[model samples]
Target: MSVHFEERSGVVPCKTPWGSWYQTMEEVSIEVNVPPGTSAKEVKCELGSRRVELVVRGQQVFKGKLFGTTVEDEATWTLEDKCLIRIVLMKANREAGNCWGSLLDGQYSADPWVQDQMQRKLTLERFQRENPGFDFSGAEISGNFAGGGPDFSNLQR
Candidate 1:
């Protein structure tokens, strides 16, 4: 899989199923809206496509997913502006033989023993306050994040 940030939309893009086919789902997008008085280091996890975008406002935050089953495992913060956002998708098979369909969550967690959560949410507010107009992107839903896009250095890291 390949990952990078797009300049035009200020969002990150992650392409998967390298040199192969996965399913019918597209790429995912995760956008984090940085707020004020927040630090960049607070926010963890490399944002990808899955079309998941986490936005932070004054006292409320928004998060969602775009592709397959989403795991709820993630990072924790001590700040007040930070919150949890999870999106899960499942597919069920309908057959009448030994080879039937099954429903399962599709996500890789950071912990080897667990397959629930992966990344941690940071204080986007701090990052935004320090820098302005930070460009960000996310991963694709279920397809490869293919692109011949431009470089992203202007985005406030």
Candidate 2:
């Protein structure tokens, strides 16, 4: 006989006389909402040159393949104490094209991680300009954290 293939939605599942094989699942766009009782320490997010992965309780829950742009090291994870976890990505280049709204897209390029970074940078600059009295001596100078972001949480003080 000949070989045949079937496609559905965004994936392909091939069925043969012996068994069946399914293709990889689609990239996860949107925010990953984990179940209740999830701890911050239990959740792990891995950011690569062009992709983002999330693992909770030892299981890979979400994955997002980004565009040509690079992501910043400082990803803001605005999570609750012991409930849900929320995060925003920071794109490297600010003068590029339109950024992706969601995490995953059917196309080759998903999203760009930039908004959060620019916002934080601007906010921090504004605050420092307005309140020069505020002491920022405890902050460390590192990778993308040269001057530091607006949020003071990262500061050691």
| TM-score top scorer | 2
Candidate 1 local lDDT, 31-103, one digit each (tens): 2334445553444432333323333343323333433433223312233343332222221211111110111
Minimum summed lDDT over a 10-residue window in model 1 is located at 94-103
Writing each residue's lDDT as its tens digit, candidate 2 over 2-119 gives: 2211121122222222122221111212244566788888888776647767788898766667553445465555446555555555556432123333334443321133433322
Candidate 2 deviation (Cα RMSD): 19.4
**Worst 10-residue lDDT window, candidate 2:** 2-11
Badly placed stretches (over 4 Å) of model 2 are 1-30, 105-157
Model 2 vs. true fold: TM? 0.41
For each candidate in turn, the TM-score is 0.20, 0.41
- What C-alpha RMSD separates each model from the true structure? 18.5, 19.4
